[model samples]
Target chain A: MDALIEKLKGQIIEQLNLAEVKPEEINPDSPLFGEGLGLDSIDALELIVLLEKHYGIKIQDPKDGKTIFQSLRTMAEYIKSQGKS
Target chain B: MDTITSYAHIKHNQVSVNGEIIFQSYPSLSLPEFLSEAYKALGVSYPKFHKMDAQCKLGFLCTEFTLNGTSFLTENDITKTAIVLSNAASSLETDRVHQHSIDDKSNYFPSPAVFVYTLPNITIGELAIKHKITGENAFFVSEQFDAGLLVNYTETLIQSGTEASVMGWVEVDGTNFEAFIFLAEKQKYTNKNAIFKPLNKTSVITIYNQTIWTH
Candidate 1:
């Protein structure tokens, strides 16, 4: 779980072109949108593409992204639940 | 009288304001590196600037520098300011990236972040959002910097109640790019430090051409 969280952090940074953000700075339990990483709608879409491109995880419902991308931990857990982690 | 108050030019890995060299990284940084260096040197905190494509970044940085030379915003209602810009490439750089993303049918993923900047006018949208400009705006794609078009259209807007304007050319095609942005006003400024050029075809052509030929 720890390894998966770290991996997701790197992926999110690279996928979103967060050049100023280091993987270590992203707290796993912190939110990915609004108050935390401060990602917007466009970044949310990019995160969706990241999941599909890297993990082969296709989110059929866009609404589920709110829960899946809540934080680094949630994203790792989602991938683990899909057996991709 | 309508006058061109302050202006900035970006090219050859250099950023100049009002015909004076303001910043340039030695060894001529790559387009991305140059833009990042210029943004850092400008000392602005627009977080969304990170997500913008090359074209928008080029225009955004140039506009910021142009506006830096004057107190136009503080003196005038920015909401009534018009923005008229022209470009040679029309977002072709980002268009190619978006096209490549969807080209491989077997491994296709079009990024919304990249895809949103597919249009040339997104550059204008970026400036509008950043400056809180709610007035008229337009983006024209021409073979080169059409000084006549820019001068005519921008002056027309200012004459028709637009308080001030930011106009010029911003072009980004692959690794080749340049931007010449200037601020113009509806009336002559009485600011002790203000040095404005007549908003006419001759001055526009002269400055825009000078920047183009400058290294």
Candidate 2:
């Protein structure tokens, strides 16, 4: 679980090019959008692609991604539920 | 009085004015292809072009030809020159890609790589760096081409004793891109002796509004 969270954090940083951000700075349970990580709609699409490419999760609907990508904890739980991790 | 001796341009490697072609070269294959070819022709590294956004690349191409290999003025002379450019889209391509990221949830994250090009001023920044032009730089956006605004601003600079003003219109829509430039200087001449005439604001508004080039 810890390793998966680390991997996810790395991916977020790389995909977003969060220049000043480090992996350790992201809180696993913190919100990934708006308040916490401050990611917007565009970042959400990139994250969705990251899921599909890395974990074989296909997000066919944008609305469904809101719940799944709320935070690292939610994303990790979803990935585990899908037997992806 | 300062005077424009000559003007030159290269679109797809062909220097031209109006419909008259001064020099012609083969058209580029694609955006990437053109960038690569331009980099090679200028003897700059390929990676450098890759690092630059589209607008910067286009601005560089236009400005390089405008200078025509003239030795850039030293720091003391730098204050005498200025750059004034106009564009239609103003980084819409960057905006489009950024909007795409938001429209599609599957791509929930935006790449910072794409975000940096969102501003229209990056082109001017690129031009200043390449040409070492440190005087004045301004970028204006219009609904369509405004030759009068360009001419008037350049004339103002010339009249103020600026050595020269590099002014132009650069517009890109999808795959089509056009750049028109004039290197101007102030001169005392009657209407008949004036090689370049400044169009009145009303005439400019009409021409731009109607998309009429021939007066």
Candidate 3:
């Protein structure tokens, strides 16, 4: 789980072109949107692409994105549940 | 015809406002690196600028400099300001970056942020959003700088309804880039004492050529 969370952090940084941010600074338990990473809608689309390209994960429902992408930990757990972690 | 009220020319390492050099780029820095440094030097803190493609960034910076000392006009009547920019590349720089994103079938990851900038006119949108400008806007693609086209279009917009126009030739491909933006206003509001050239094809072409060639 720790390794998965760490990997997701790197992926998010690179995929979003968050050049000023370091992986260590991204707290796994913190929110990925709003108060945490402060990413916008466009970044959400980039994250969706990241999931599809890296883990072969296709989120069927848009509503599920809120829970699945709440944080790095949540995303990792969701991937694990899908058996693709 | 409208007369030029303000202008800025930006190259890789230097930025000239009204034909006067104001900012110099570090020769050692790469294009991306120089842009980052230039943004810092300009004391602008817009985070979205970091996400923009090279063409948009160049246009944004050029406009910022063009309107630098004209804060009174920009702050008072932003809605009256229009933008008409022409370029040779027409977002080809961002297209290349976007193409690379989806080209690798094994590692395909098309970024939405990058994809949004695939259109050249996106720079006009960016400028409008930044300045709250709701006036006329247009983007043209030509083989080279078309002084006649820019002059005609800008003059028509000014004559029709718009009070002023920010005309530019913003072209970018990788590290090689050039941007020259001029703010043209009707003769009624122009100051006689101000050292501004009239908005005509010959003068515009001369300034444009001088900006690129002198560098």
lDDT of each: 0.88, 0.65, 0.83
Instruction: List TM-score per model, in order.
Output: 0.94, 0.56, 0.87
lDDT of 3 by residue, B21-88 (tens): 78886666777777777787788777678778888888888898888767536443567778899999
Task: Please tell me which predicted candidate would have the highest DockQ against the true structure.
Answer: 1
Candidate 3 — which residues are off by over 4 angstroms? A1-7, A20-31, A34-36, B72-76, B187-194, B210-215
How would you encode candidate 2's per-residue C-alpha lDDT over B94-196 as one tens digit per residue? Answer: 7887788778786565555577678777777767666567767778999876877776776676667666566666666567666655555444324554333
- In terms of TM-score, which candidate is strongest? 1
lDDT of 2 at A51: 86
Quote the lDDT for A29 in model 2.
93
Pairs clashing within candidate 3: B13-B25
Model 3 local distance difference test score: 0.83
Q: Supply candidate 1's per-residue lDDT for A26.
A: 90
Indicate the TM-score of model 3. 0.87
Query: Distance (Å) between predicted and true CA of B136, model 2?
Result: 1.7
RMSD per prediction, one decimal? 2.0, 10.8, 2.7
lDDT of 1 by residue, B1-215 (tens): 67888889998898888777888886467899999999999998887888899999999999999888578888778789888999888889999999999999999999999999999999999999987888999999899989999988987787688988889999998778999998888776454654478888888876775553345
**Model 1 residue pairs with clashes:** none
**Ranking under TM-score, best-scoring first?**
1, 3, 2
DockQ for all models: 0.77, 0.06, 0.59
The lDDT ranking, best first, is 1, 3, 2
Q: What is the lDDT for B123 in model 3? A: 96
C-alpha DockQ for predicted model 1: 0.77
